[model samples]
Target: MGSEKPSLLKGTVDAVKACPREIFNFWLFFCTAVWSFSGVAKGFDEGNIASIVVMKSFKTRFVLDHETDDQYANTKGWIVAMATAGAVFGCLACVNLVQRLGRKNTLLVFTLVYIAGIFGQTFSSGSLSGLYASRFIAGLGIGTTTVIPSIYLTEIAPRSIRGLITLQYACCQQLGVVFGFFFNYGITKHNAGTQLQWQLPTALQLIPAVIWGVGLLFTPESPRYLLSKNKRTEALKVLCDLRNLPEDHPYIQEEFAGIEWQLNAEIEAVSGASVWDLTKETFTVTENRRRFVLMFLCHMFGQWSGANAITQYSPTIFGYLGIAGEESRFLATGLYGIVKFVSVLIFSIFIIDFIGRRRSLITGICLQIVTLTYVGAYLGVTNKMSTADIEASSSATAASKASIVAIFLHAVAWSIGWFSIPYLVSAEVFPIRIRSLNVSILMAFHWAFYFGCSRAMPSLLAATHRFGAFAFFASICTCSLIYVFFALPETAGRSLESMDRLFERPWYTVRQVAYPTAADLADGGLGDVERKITDEDLNKVTEVRIESQTSKNH
Candidate 1:
């Protein structure tokens, strides 16, 4: 029996050693998807609200029937924009709670909070104020959920497929959006004038939150977080389990050492630093500041890409495009949601790592610019023709069809590049010590920008008309393309621990830096990078200390 046990153990080890990279990566991806369910909850709200806003039952319940068209539009914008405002507060609040409670626990707490918000919305009646408050509460949960999952996924994912794994956040979010749209469509079709039309769709938000909270019990806490808390033995064991390797394995050893080295360097630099001091260092350090700027711009431009304007007001946009009838508009919106979901899935799974980050972003933005501009021109001509009393002309119908096609094309292009890249890049850009803080701040800015766009879009449309509104969005896309071309680095396959070296250069003069191969990782290639980063960080700490002492003496 003893002899047989030894032989079995040896065979199992050999089999693990011979396992293919693709199989291993797929397992990791599966694990990532389980944690990314929080995104689905947020996406559900995003898609559901947009659809609900156009429902006759929703407007009637809110007493929008007594309001003018302008008042109705403004009220609708406020309802949709309130969630983003809540998200900004949630993200800012998470900066402290995530670090204190740890990522997994914090997520659980937020999930409960989200459930409360959903209950409020599901049962809301009589007053729009109650609905607004409920949406804001949901937004808080979404904000924390959005930031935490990306951080967890980034920390756990293998370097070779980190981008692909992180992009799942976007994929799951779009999936949630698809579910929301279809759920609303079905409810609207059957329960059009009943309160159930909006109430049922609102209630569906609980499903993803419940699933995510239950799954959190089984999921492991992040190994990197363990290391940060000085639990080295626990960190190592978790790393081994995650990688499906033994403690003595070369990859396991290198990754653990890299984490320890980076953590040590951060401690040395900010040994006695307070939260305020770390915040200062985030801006004062050249590399950190550069990354901050890049992340912020990526997120800011992503919101301004006109996606919210189209997505949040899809029924309205379709109405403007001459698509008649409520049922047709809702069906079109559902189809639009599906196209977005599929396009993002395809790009995240098949093309993200293949094309590299910088090129993909630029190319995607360029396509957005073209599509938006074409849609604008068509709308401009059609609007002028309508004013001239040629309402049923063939050219008007043809232009309307072309504009709809352009909108679908825009979704495809946005999904491939702009939709997910900003979040992926933000998650990958920061160091372990300040990652939570940095990402929280960045996402807060993101939600703030989202709120701005969502709030102002209705007004912008009112002022600019359909054609001018698209032109404005096209102009933003153009600016975004130029900024990405010059500022964003290629971060597709790089190790998270290597971010210091990755951003060491000036932002303008960039080159493609490939990730270390298996052989390179095993042979201590990353060790050399870690050492350089350590030396530089320590030197900066020394210089700062000396300057501080001198000033004190003076």
Candidate 2:
């Protein structure tokens, strides 16, 4: 009876240790999806149509009320630009803070900042100073949200579904954009008062921000951050919780050990022991520098792809398509947002791995080139020709509708390609220690370009015709595509440890990491022949080396 009891207890322990890894992954996915929704809220409202629409409302609510004598009319653009400026500061501040405070707490701070900003918006008087302050405060929140979510998601998610989870962050941002447009439109359609129309949209964002703050308070810190802090037991607990496995499970043990091994291995190269040093790659190892440069290039390429301009000025772009009236423009913007959300959601689920990162990015850029070229041609021809000729050649409605379609297609290409790739890459490629700082700088460029492209668009569109503006964007896409082809690595299905191994080789370039098709995942796939390290057996060499040394000594 005693022997039987021991056997039964052992069996139960083994079963607990064998919880499916996929369940942990799914839980991480769920948590990430929830956290992501908050980050997207600001973009949906501030970056897309909401800011512009609110500015336009200032004309009726404040400018005319002051008898047009006040310069509040002229200050609307500055008010709108204020958020971007605040974001710049917020982004820079986060670089040090994210690592110092930790991912979960840093994110919670952002939600609070956002909630405070939203509360301020309710009291805004449409004065130049008031609007500027509010926008700047909101911008800080926006900047923090943009960069922190990527850092958190990357740290917590598994390698197998990293791209999907990272891209899910991007997708949620787009979905938020769509919701903001609808919310603004719905609010205005019922009552166009400043309080109802503009204030409500800004205020509504706080609901999600509050929810995120509370949720993150209860959430575990990144296991990587835990390890970096030398809280090994806590790190293991996080890993087990995040992986949905018992602490004793073999694969869980392997991942935890691998993370520890890499951290210890790198620390051995460094003289000091501090989290700040870790964030800076203070040891100056080759793998560390490679990861830093890759993230830098990924962000540089992400911005150069014209993604921000599309996101920040979709309504304006639709207006350039010749849609007159505010409602018409907002409707078009709504449709563009919807297409972006759907495209990202679809690709992340079905094609992120299959299409591979490099190919999808190139495909996206190529599509942008094609669509922008056609739109530019049409606009250029119309501008150069006589009004009579344009009218005779095509109806205004037809031309406008065609332009909208082209822009929508451009959004579609981006959501699947450039829009999601940078965040995905930033999250996946870096070492755990420096993930936050790296993603912060990367998204800084992203938001910086976002601010630049957005702030510049109104004036640029005024100066250059639609054809000229789009031509510049098309040119950017061309250069970015070429760069991505040469620089981006595939990273599909590669474990974090295996990816580190690639960095160890010293001879590989970005092209080597591009995604292979379904054929690659097949039994005889080219990738298998080229790089066939099994996920379960990566650290076998360490054991082999130890055994061989023992045999020789004996």
Candidate 3:
């Protein structure tokens, strides 16, 4: 599998086409749905910060009025980015935590940390330092929450629906964002001047964390993690339950065989390897290093594509587009949130898997390029007008309305491609041996950029026109589209181990390895690949595996 194009289609066709019972089960969906709630925790935090900062009570309590423009920008930047900074540390720390505690426990533990951060944030009152520290502490939870769920989902989900399952985390994140927006809107309408207006949203972040923590208790630990711990019997049982099939079912056996094959290979690689040896290998090995570089670029590109800036600065951007007043801008921002949530939901359900990762990314990036460029060009013309003339001109207002529409379209486009795919690619692209280390490294970079980009928005917008920022984002999206179209492989339907082999190809040719022909699988990959599984076949496979182990051990 490390060097061969294994029959990815084999499992889907033989397992599902020949199986007695269905592969997709209620429990499998239920467990994944529960795990996906962790995304909500991260999203809730992301969605609320900008809105909360704009609230009158939040501003007054924090005493934000006295600062000069630059000072105000710096303070606001720190306030918004601190949670992400904490998340960076959390992401880095998760590699060891996930390995030691297993995915479910790691999530539960982090959820508690997240909940505690919420408490401190809600009650910190006027203390900015306390709020920043608390958000950082909460970010530690967020960093782990964001990465672990994708890893866990990748390990547990069926290959056919793995993309869909992983994307559900993204969907849940959008749901939480929607909650953040509407919660702020509802509070503004009902609780306007009270501390509760801000505190309610901050405290409300706890609901998702609490639900995820409680749900983790009932969910199964990742079967792959169990197997890694040498809990083979338990792992097999969990796999059976997850698949809703007999332990001896062909689908079960084939899936087990693929995973076992890779685990054995990893054990062999790490048998006498020291910490330095593994670390060196992670960098020195061509495949491992390639995966790392690819992951780093993907996350970096996603952040720089300008979606976070839009979400975090939506109200302000709306104002720049000439949407008048605090209430109107906030209302427009809430609608922006709804647009994002609905777009992601639609993309996840109908588009992601069907289009596959590369196509989805390309399509989305193209749309973003168009929308961003139009917005930038529109503002370039209109910014030259006098305030009275611009306000009085119907044509200026028409262009402004069009820019808002473009922003919403950009959200739709961003959701389709960059928003969800990077995490899924991170989850499925690496083998278990380096999966945690790799995902943690990449996610930390992501959060770091998230912090940098979101934090820099105030300065970026101030130093340049909003149009210039949009133009820069559009340029980045253009570069991103080129990178994705040529470099990123389609990872939608393949088994995880297959990804190792897929990347084993020369870096330039990696994109060509997504799907193998029937003849290719039979001749060089999984032999006799398309036949139904039988008892005799399983026994023969087991015999070969045993003999290989015996000879290697000797």
Candidate 4:
């Protein structure tokens, strides 16, 4: 194995070079990066609120009369969770809107809605009712923007680099988190208890929304959406533009043909199928059902992995560890955001495609399980210690430092596994016909669980303290590890059109599944290998195609 490592690395490098570099042209890069602003908006909302809640001014302005600590904690959780609650409705509403309005238009409309919500949030500091209403509206925008970008990026990206490109969403989200944290930290450190400290951060959310919305106007509509609507000429044109290739390029023709064929197959399958029938088939069809379960479970596991709890309540967690002082808490929170940002950035660039989806998720989850267990145990023991003893004992200080290290490590692990895979897998697994609807359904569950976890974190910490909450999350990670090991298939480097065959087999199958060639489908040879094809079959077809093309040139 050690001797073969260099050969394998060389082969991988050769394969990458064989692909066209034109795919990374300026226009494509611009569009892909701009689409990430939606994620930034989401990250900003999540991170900004967490920091704002810890602000003295925010609490002074918003906390109720004669509110106890528990009540205050609940109020903080609710305020932080309101955006997620709004996101649920937005996800559900976008199911049909995406199909009708198309990806670009849907994102544009919702971004405006998000900006509107931001204005409300900025100005409504005087009234809690207005604040809640504005957040829910913004949540609606977030839901729509979040789901559409994944779909759009998946459709636009070339299959070879799809995983890496799609990961832009996660990277941008972390970027937003970092910005939010530092923005809040700066305001808190300088502005102190002034309303502008919180208000300025709230207002800053508008920048990404406007940038994404305006950028959408310049970017073309999704070719997949165009094809789905039977705009063949427009789809072809957009494909050419996106690839920076001509209409007659063989690669372009092959890709277009593949998409058309897959769309036709789906149309044939769902010819007379009603909404109820489609939903029923989604669960009853073995392949569809399996994919749905995996995607849903992935989302659930990612959210329940304690990422949001740590992010949304980092200050509180620091406090629980006996790290007192507002400046210290904010500094810790800022460091947490920075670590997450850097970790996610590194994973997206290096590990995502290299390790494949299954291994990355399992490895990350296992690491999390160990970290959570250690943190939970340490916190539990410390909770039992008297304040005087804790202050004087060197062991307590050492344990506190260890807990901080554990939390940072947990962030790194979560970044590698749960942060982006759920979205990437969901975008790739579902058939194009039902992609929007299926993804929306799963996203709703994501937001719902996100809301639950965020809302419950404060109360959970109040009722169970540090140990109970961390242990509970650790148990969830354990279950996630088992499920991933037994169920989730590797999807890295697979074509979107080939996912149906990929999920049809049992989990134990180790051989690569071959997708049928264009000629095979045209000659009605698809009948022979409609179920599954092996790697050898694909190589044979490729060799024949190369030979025929060479012969024609001669």
Candidate 5:
């Protein structure tokens, strides 16, 4: 028999090919879908359901004007606002807690918040305070859900499919919102004033949470978290379960080693290494700082594109534009969800590598600017139309239709760019030592902006009206595109370490080369392959550098 050559690269490739695709993809999709269940409620839950149905029911059934007539006008915004606020607080508070609690525990806690929020929104009575409080609690859960899932998925996913899996979360979010808007539209259409109608919709939100919590209880916690706990054997077992591998699987060893090496490397970057060791590494290391900056900018740009405003208040924006039929608008929003979901799926399967991150971001942001600009112009012109102009013609009606088109396009553009890529990039760029902490900080900014944008957008649109708000988001998109065009690197086919190296150096090669070209790597390399390193050599470096740095810093 011919001797078999020891081939590290070939073995790695074989392991990936041998891994179970369905199991990995299922968790990614399921986690995404569970959190996205609330997306359906974003538009209607914000007093719209109360306005359209609940308040009127209270008036007719109980002869309560305060409950039925003016209740939503006075209180719905705050109710809607509370969830966003709760999410902000939840994410920030959980930043340190996420590190301690680990990914799976945090996710489970958030799922419980969903269950609590739904039951409260469904059965609670009298004051709106209970409903709002529940949503606020849910929002805390929602923020954590949003942040941690992306972190977990990014960590567990193979680099090749990580971007696609991350994008699934964004799709689920949009799909949930789309579904909620349309689902309520259907439920309230003929019945209109049924309290039972609102109850059913709010109650449905808990289904995914129940499923996710139940399903994940049986599933493994993140192998990365297992490793951090120094439970190597358990981590290996979790990896095997997650990847459908045997205990002696070669790739299992490689990935475990990769994470360990990365962690050990970060320990070397710190001094007086205590519990805050991760933070020390991030601040002191040149590469870690650069990765943080890149991830930070991604969040800043992603939020700046106005994704929250659109998803949170699409129906309100449609109403402002004078879209006549709530039913048709809701249908269109559902269609928008379908488009986003399909587009994300397509991108995940085919376009992610071909188009690359930098180009996709630029394209999505630029398209967003254009769509928002068009919407603004239409609204601006309609806002200027006089009472006579309004009565004499159907100009506002035409503008509303145009506005829907623009909004749909904006959602599509976001699916292509700002919605999913930032999370994927944030999770991918960081080393294993501080991946959770780093992602938490970036997601904190993300959800904070989400809270700010959604809460402020309604008031902004109500006050400045459509023209100003749309234009403002458009301007933000322009700036984001410019930033991507200049600063971001093309990490399409790069390895994790190579991605780290791209940011660590003073210059970005991908930015310099307008397209993927021969000059982009050392000796025209693709820069996607993993390098093999021995545990002995890795430990030697870890011992020497860490002790040196700690002694010097202390």
Candidate 6:
């Protein structure tokens, strides 16, 4: 087990098999799923926006006709991308909320902003001003939606199944996609020419926000967060409840010890540092800077991959590929959403931990490269895809059918590769001391690029004739491929505390090899099999670190 990059899932898989019933239980799953529910509204908004924009009621209300095609694209881009622009602000605001209010409370308070934003938008009949303001307001609430949930899950999760739990946040986002696409299609189909067609879909976001708020009332504060506040007894009780283990049990003691070690490591870094000092440590420290760069490229390249273009403008993209009717476009978009949801669910549950993080990303990226290239070449050879209603062919041509398949394939590749990988990787890889600041900064970039992609998608397609845009996305995917292969270390089965060791090796070769490649040792301290530390050693650290901090204060 102490050999080369040991089979990625062996640590988790063995743990699951050995204690399937005892370790993984209903309580743990329940708490994780409730927070994951927050993603539904985000997904619905993202998927629903593009579909709703093409609705007859929406077009009528917005008076979408413009003097030029470029004018029309710009207007639509602003409408869809505005929420993300607000999201950038939300990310900036989240650190203060999470720091002062705690993770659960921050989410609870923001649900109202999200709900208020949705309420304002649903009722915005003919006012472009109102619609834009609503989108931005909702964006404020939505920004915290993803960042906090992933942080909470990773913090509370048992080491063995942490990846599975954290990825659930992404899984639920797809579930939202399913609801968003299908709901828009259902409403548009039933309502037809009525204003309810757009209003109902727009208002559907409130349901998830309400559910997440109520659930937050019952959810526990992150045990790690509690430890950070020096609530030792409270932190232990929370850990016991979360792990479903006795307070003094070896597993519980070691798990608590690992967190203390990380906390101590954090204290050692700044040692009574203030906010400004912490911010400086974020940049001045080599590891922190390296993680920051990884985050920048993680999102920037991801947005350029063109998958988001497909997600935000699938109806438009399909229409360009020669799909001919409003009904058909909506149907195709709805189905595309389903494919992404199913792919994420299957892979997160069955495959992600098994293949390891880097491999899953690599496999998905390869699929994206192949599919994007084919779609680009097909559009080039045909030179005929359009957003306008072209006459429906008597029968689907082979080339068009293949392009449709290629687009769906592209969605699948996106679902598996870039969809959740960036968030999951970002959530698990950083030290907890600066995790919130880093995550906020990372997601600010996430939404910033998201805003850029959504805002530019229409114009990019319009300017590039759809074909060149696809080619450009393929090129970006190629760069992400190289980055993942060279930069990201495998994170599967590692405890959060041990992530530092993964980056301890030189930057250039991080992806080439992992430290403590042995699966058992990968847990850093919690490894049940061949663990290097004893239960007493864990208890000793727990006691000594607290006393050391106390004595220093005196």
TM-scores across all candidates?
0.82, 0.75, 0.83, 0.84, 0.77, 0.85
For model 3 the local lDDT of residue 432 reads: 51
Tens-place lDDT digits, model 6, residues 1-554: 34444343565687667543555767778789898888886788888898887776687788875437777788888999999899889878887879888998888888888999999999987899999999999998888886788879888888777766777788788888788888887877788778888889888878888887888888899988999999989999988887788787888888898787766555554446687877798789877888778877988887888887788888887876788666788888889988988887887776765676788889989999998898888777667633332234423356677888998988888867787788777756666567656777777888899889989888887788778888988999998898888888776556543556556666668865643355423444343212323354446556767898899999
Clashing pairs in 5: 39-176, 39-177, 40-176, 40-177, 40-180, 55-68
Q: Write the per-residue lDDT of candidate 2 for residues 1-554, one digit (tens) a residue.
A: 22111222343345445656454556676578677776676556554334444345655644534433234323434555667777888888887887799988887786677677767766667554666677688789888887778767877765544545666677777778787776666766665654566777667777767777777776788898899897989999988888888899887887787676555444433425465677657238787777766666666556655656566666656655666556666666677778877887787666655556777888888998998887887777676554455446666647756877888888878877877777667656665446545666666777776666656655554456657777887888887777677656676545555567656644346466454334333232222212333333335445554776799999
| Candidates in descending lDDT order | 4, 3, 6, 1, 2, 5
Name the TM-score of candidate 3.
0.83
Candidate 3 collision pairs: none
Clash tally for model 6: 0
- Candidate 1 clashes between residue pairs 3 or more apart in a chain or in different chains: none
Give lDDT: candidate 3, residue 460.
Answer: 74
Q: CA lDDT, every prediction?
A: 0.77, 0.66, 0.79, 0.79, 0.63, 0.78
Per-residue CA lDDT of model 1 for 163-261, tens digit only, reads 556777878888888888888888888888999989998898898888888988878888888888878799888777778788897788877877766
Alpha-carbon runs more than 4 Å astray in model 6: 1-13, 17-26, 232-264, 274-291, 384-396, 427-436, 483-554
Error of 5 at 342 (Å): 2.2
Number of clashes recorded per candidate: 0, 4, 0, 0, 6, 0
The residue-level lDDT of candidate 6 at 218 comes to 86
Q: Which ten residues in a row have the lowest lDDT in candidate 5?
A: 524-533
Better of 4 and 5 by lDDT: 4
Evaluate model 3: give its lDDT.
Answer: 0.79
**Residue-wise lDDT of candidate 5 within 162-281, one digit each (tens)?**
545555565566566655666666766765667755666667676656766787675567778788787889888866665666766676677777777665654443434554777778
> What's the distance in Å from true for residue 276, model 1?
2.8
Cα-based lDDT at residue 317, candidate 2: 62
- The residue-by-residue lDDT of candidate 4 on 269-355, one tens digit each, is 456778787788789998888888888889899999999878988887887777776677878888899899999888877676667
Candidate 2 vs. true structure, TM-score: 0.75
